[model samples]
Target: MTASTKPYLLRALYEWCLDNNQTPHIVVWVNEHTRVPAQYVRDNEIVLNIGQTASHNLSIDDEWVHFSARFSGVAHDIWIPVGHVISIFGRESGEGMGFEVEPYQPENTDTQADKPQAAADKPAEAAKPKKGLKLVK
Candidate 1:
């Protein structure tokens, strides 16, 4: 199997934004695999400022984009699956790329290799957002 090009493109665009002195932001599709401030999500999505000034310990890897940032004066650690990123664009120029949201699919594992014991023991449904909110068209 071949690796997806999405992560590479994301990194490239992020670097481009920084080179041009623009703030980079990402549109994230909130899902079970995403760990963000749920209270700030709108329409099941959140826009995150990923620029150096806004985020700390930022990492954009093949599978995840991890960072910590202040939201409403409180620090929050953000964990976003690369597949859930809808788009990344410059806040000033709005130049970047968008990708189709990919559904989270847990890899099948026997004995759950490499996964933390606690995480492996937790039920998948436990990570899901609570129901009650609905998007009105």
Candidate 2:
């Protein structure tokens, strides 16, 4: 089995943003398992700036991207599964790559994983936007 290219692309894009003197931002899909500042999420998605000035201890790995940052004077620990990342781009020009969002599957869960109909019904619900933060395209 080969490693997924998503993580590698994420790292490369982040570095490209830095090298170009642009702020790097990531758009993520928030779900029950995603650990993020809820107040900052809207439409089940959030755009985050991961520039050097915005985050600390930033790490982008095969499974997860973790970092610490302050929001409204309060520090927050952001943990996002790579599967939930929609895109990574520059805040200046919005130039970056978008990744396909893979359906989150728990390793040992037995909840509708085998049911295609149940899975098909989820998209409508997922399309509904929650109110709060604004999504950047």
Candidate 3:
């Protein structure tokens, strides 16, 4: 949980964004050997814009009770921040808790991520790197 003392690297990143007033958008990752439908994975890692939604009182663990990312679909209404996020689909044991957490890191193809004409996936095409999205507001 983002509110806990656990080492939530993703939440740390998002917190860094919030402190700077930048919206945090994340790309939830999967094991390199895994394959799943996009719809099933979209909300797994969200691209939250964190507009001015008032923090609510919905219950979760006491520490995770804070303003979080709210997105479409998914049953849960709000997110518990990156710190709260541990493992989403059990990347560790491959059979671990479906909602358990591990750690998170933003993909850092920053240089290529800035290019306009590059495809979203930025398919590996021989050394040229893929790009990353940096919110400017």
Candidate 4:
């Protein structure tokens, strides 16, 4: 993926998984990437540290997410628990085609993905936002 499209890739992935009824895994497809500061990462995954992701279009569930991110220290993937997610933001540019995996509600299995459902499917829309990976292909 291109540099301009790296950020939003995660959000697209999350949406993709939701559309396909699958789960999105957080991963860094690029060799060089920045890591979200440790202090930013939290226990309940308050934020989806943009640095946590390596490529665009990658994503993960909002429920206590945990990932093995590369950050920038080494050439390998390191463990980044849900607590590590310091921020949750959207992709700034790209084809707008990425995806992420979030907690599925049995009640909203029939409804649409983007449409906010009743209390059953999505209890509170303001509860917490999930993280996404910005990478495709």
C-alpha local distance difference test of each model: 0.80, 0.78, 0.35, 0.33
TM-score of 3: 0.27
The sequence of per-residue lDDT tens digits that candidate 3 reaches over residues 1-137 is 24544325444544555565554443334332112223545545532233234323322232232333333533333423233343322222232122345442334535556433222232343113222533332
Model 1 stretches astray by more than 4 angstroms: 108-137
Highest-lDDT candidate: 1
Tell me each candidate's TM-score: 0.81, 0.77, 0.27, 0.23
* Model number with the top TM-score: 1
Q: Which segments of model 4 are wrong by more than 4 Å?
A: 1-13, 16-62, 75-87, 93-137
Question: Best to worst by TM-score, what's the order?
Answer: 1, 2, 3, 4
Q: Measured by TM-score, how close is model 1 to the native structure?
A: 0.81
Better of 2 and 4 by lDDT: 2
Residues 1-137, candidate 2, lDDT per residue (tens digit)? Answer: 99999999999999999999999999999896467888999999999999999999898877778888999999877777788999999999989999999755555324334423322233332312344533232
Give a tens-digit lDDT track for model 1, residues 36-85: 88898999999999999899988887777888899999988787878899
What does candidate 4's lDDT look like per residue over 1-137, in tens digits? Answer: 43333234445555654465443334322111123344434442323333324433233433223233344553322223222233333333222232332323333323335433221232232122333433121
Worst 10 residues of 4 by lDDT: 27-36
